[model samples]
Target chain A: MAGSNPGCGTTRTFKYQVRDQFGQVMLVYNMQLWDSIVTTSTNTCNLGGYNTTCAITNTGPCNVGTFADGTFNENLGICAPAGHLVSGGCITGCTTTADQTWNINGISLSGDVKNLSYQCDRSW
Target chain B: MYTLLLATLLLQPIWALPPPPSEQGLQVKLRANLENYTVAAETFPQALTKVAAQFEIPMGIEWIRTSATQREIRRSWRHTTVYGVVESLVKSQSGYDFAIANGVIHVFPKGALMDRSSFLNHRINKFEAKNEFAGVLSYRLRELLKRTISPPLPSSPALGTAGSIATGAGDRRITFRLVNASVRQILDKLSLATDFRIWIVTYPEDRTLTETGFRRVASLYTSSSVADNEQPVWAFLRWGDALPK
Candidate 1:
């Protein structure tokens, strides 16, 4: 995975994997970023869609009856149960959504692209 | 005197162009037989289909066979072919046929008053790129026609595929028949020579039929062949994903 950074106007591969306490690897996600630097000029990178290759691991002893599932928002950010949080920020953005749009493999991300206030809801 | 010699050199007869190879005479001899080709004994229908479509001409496949052997002994096949062209009433026509024996293809052309001949030659090569391998073949079969025949008239109809038949055993063995026009078209389009074949082996279970998996296998074929000093004589394409640990 240690390769040259994708060119400014080109695409690059961005991947993520989820692991449980016992180091058992779970789900893995992969994406292709059309451009690494996402600013007003270059604002989009394809977020890899869901992966069926890896399973979700819920192997924690402190788990309640309900499973603690984690979800990733390519546009908004990463979300976990109230008590649990994705430490490293698996999801990037929420910094600025003004004139910026996000897509994964050519599909636009579902949800609100703007906030009721004039301010852009650019955090995730 | 030097100027005179130079002028003489420039005056050399253009008609002195060497005659076609002896093997390519008026009647191109498509070796009496043909041969079948394979990669480690397995036939890759997808690659065959794709390449066949790419290399062959429009209708040139009429001269080949879909399946030449019976079920029992399947090793023998024909890989090369030959053709000849003749003139008829104000119009020009060509006859084409093939003979297979021992993994080679020999094409022969036939027709009324057919008085022309030509030869074609082919060769295959492989290369490496990024995480994959690539394969290509150099072809010159037209010479084969010219050498076997004396004078060749204009070629007739282009070549393409007749059809294909596929049968596989579980997940291990697969067989395919790419005959006639289809075969000729692929070789022609790719300019594939006879020196080697290209194989694209897949990973069996890859659900994604996209070009990524197929292209990777093709690249591997070239890279491996180059390292072994052997050109990509054949290709094997498969698709599969790794099992969970």
Candidate 2:
């Protein structure tokens, strides 16, 4: 969503989160200005039995609770309007064009696997 | 001596004592406390209505009707008789008058109402117009003068034709192009184009006056300055006040 202008010589930030079924904190996605250049948020998840299940917390200031039923897709990094599909942020394919790079450590046989970080792109 | 005193007392009449004021004679009484009422600038009629309402006179209806109902009147009152305030309001306007009928004061046009004999005795004020078909503007001018213009009872709208005057004294086309014109100006324009004379009106057996020429004749008028901020200036045609010949 295109948030309103904070006015001349000001800034604004939108905060997001991922929690479990019982509102347990699992991830924090904060989109903010990079010193005055770009706006992006980075987070990781596990999918395909990758030892991760995350849910989006669209609460006010960012309250989209109407579609925050906990279901999310791994590849698209999106959620269904009414179901609870849990997946991780890590992908098997490697791409050099990634903007963010991080490490994902899970309970599977995966070691400290280096992976490209991602953020949900919502532009209005 | 006791018998004589009793006869004297009984002979005195109760009517000798003067009666108190009746309800009609009593001054206006406010239903609310408005001694400190100071409002923003408003028209004369609006102010009069506000002041009258202090004495519980109803507002928000066409209580006042006249051609010269002043739009702006600035005055105040404190502990004055209601009719006195009303008289002051009447003085604030021109070509306007008021009357008390059945104990309720009404502000109306100068010649708004008249009896059958009086109606025929009075003459419609002299009016002059130079632009447009004075005939059409006459009715529109009358509409502007009324507090509540009584439009002809609704009927299916239709256009009846009248031929040229030279051909057989037929109908003529009157034009109107006024911009913020006053009631007097409108009446003037109507007088010039139409024969300033208002004919006694008549209706055909067909229930429409489209054809004209049955019997009765009367004139009406109204005026006010209550148009809101965007008092429109009509300018469809170049029909302006005709210059002197």
Candidate 3:
């Protein structure tokens, strides 16, 4: 009787630390009500046409739920379990998409040059 | 009487004045001309290190670990000073920049240099070290930052996960004292005082992370020539590719 009746699964929040190549902590994110069965897919293409040129598709289990911060996309599946680390792709170059001015240590630096953006690993 | 004194001072030979501060040595070295310099293909740090060694000048290089860093850098400079070569190399790269401070060449990312939230700008009340090994001193500085920062940096077991600190009778030692100095200044002082001249700090390039968070995972690189037991903290590799034991 005990084996026949399964109780409701417990819900818990999971925390993931995104680290860099040097094992430095880049950022931290939390996921709530993680559904192990959920999966997500993404399609990326180069400058060429999607069908005629280079195209890549990635499909993985959707481990990430809502991000505490609004900066990242909601459907990001990069965060994995404690032992299951994810590899974010390398930044292509020094060019950044952040357009803002910064006044650092009494010196004002303003330009389109801003924070470097990471190109996520589509290989996953 | 005052006019006479002023005239006498003006008449004194310029050589009587003290030589420029030691910090100007870096400028002099940078301006020294080179007939030719060439590199087939190497990382920016590798190219810069080769040049720095040729000039026998100390340098500190900081950057983000990216495909760009591993990208082959091939350049040849003819009839140029060290300054020209450095300027050209950094300008050719998108996110890199350099600053000469405290008699050390510091190559770093433009964003890390300009980001107001960088831990480099954190102020320390007092920092004093006597006859300290270069690697140990560097570790202490990081510890100081972790302990003193107001909001406090995130605690991680990885912080203790660095290459083994080299120790021996033959190890180089340094001594310095500073009051009210920024972490950047401390690093410059350390570079100037140690044989581990080539310092590199690598940052993560995640746009979603807060600027301050970059410091948490930044890796420090220094000269590999110290001793057989001594080695640089980490080699250039992708994140999570390998974990240190």
The clash numbers for all candidates, in the given order, read 113, 27, 3
DockQ scores for all the models shown?
0.01, 0.00, 0.01
Task: Give me the overall lDDT of model 1.
Answer: 0.20
Q: Tell me the TM-score of model 3.
A: 0.49
**Which residue segments of model 1 deviate by more than 4 Å?**
A5-124, B1-29, B32-70, B74-133, B136-195, B198-245
Runs in model 2 with CA error above 4 Å?
A1-124, B1-41, B58-70, B115-245
Candidate 2 per-residue C-alpha lDDT over A31-114 given as tens digits, one digit per residue, 9 for 90 to 100: 110100111232121111110111101101110111132211111122211111213221222111122111112112122121
Per-residue CA lDDT of model 3 for A78-115, tens digit only, reads 11212222233222211112221222112233321223
Model 3: CAPRI class: incorrect
- Regarding TM-score, does 1 or 3 come out ahead? 3
Candidate 3 CA-lDDT value = 0.41
The residue-level lDDT of candidate 3 at B203 comes to 54
DockQ of 3: 0.01
Q: Give the true-structure RMSD of model 1.
A: 25.8
* Per-residue accuracy of model 1 over A21-51 as CA lDDT, tens digit each: 4545423232211111122321122211111
lDDT, candidate 3, B196-233, per-residue tens: 45555545444323333424333332211211111112
Interface RMSD of 1: 32.1
Best candidate, lDDT: 3
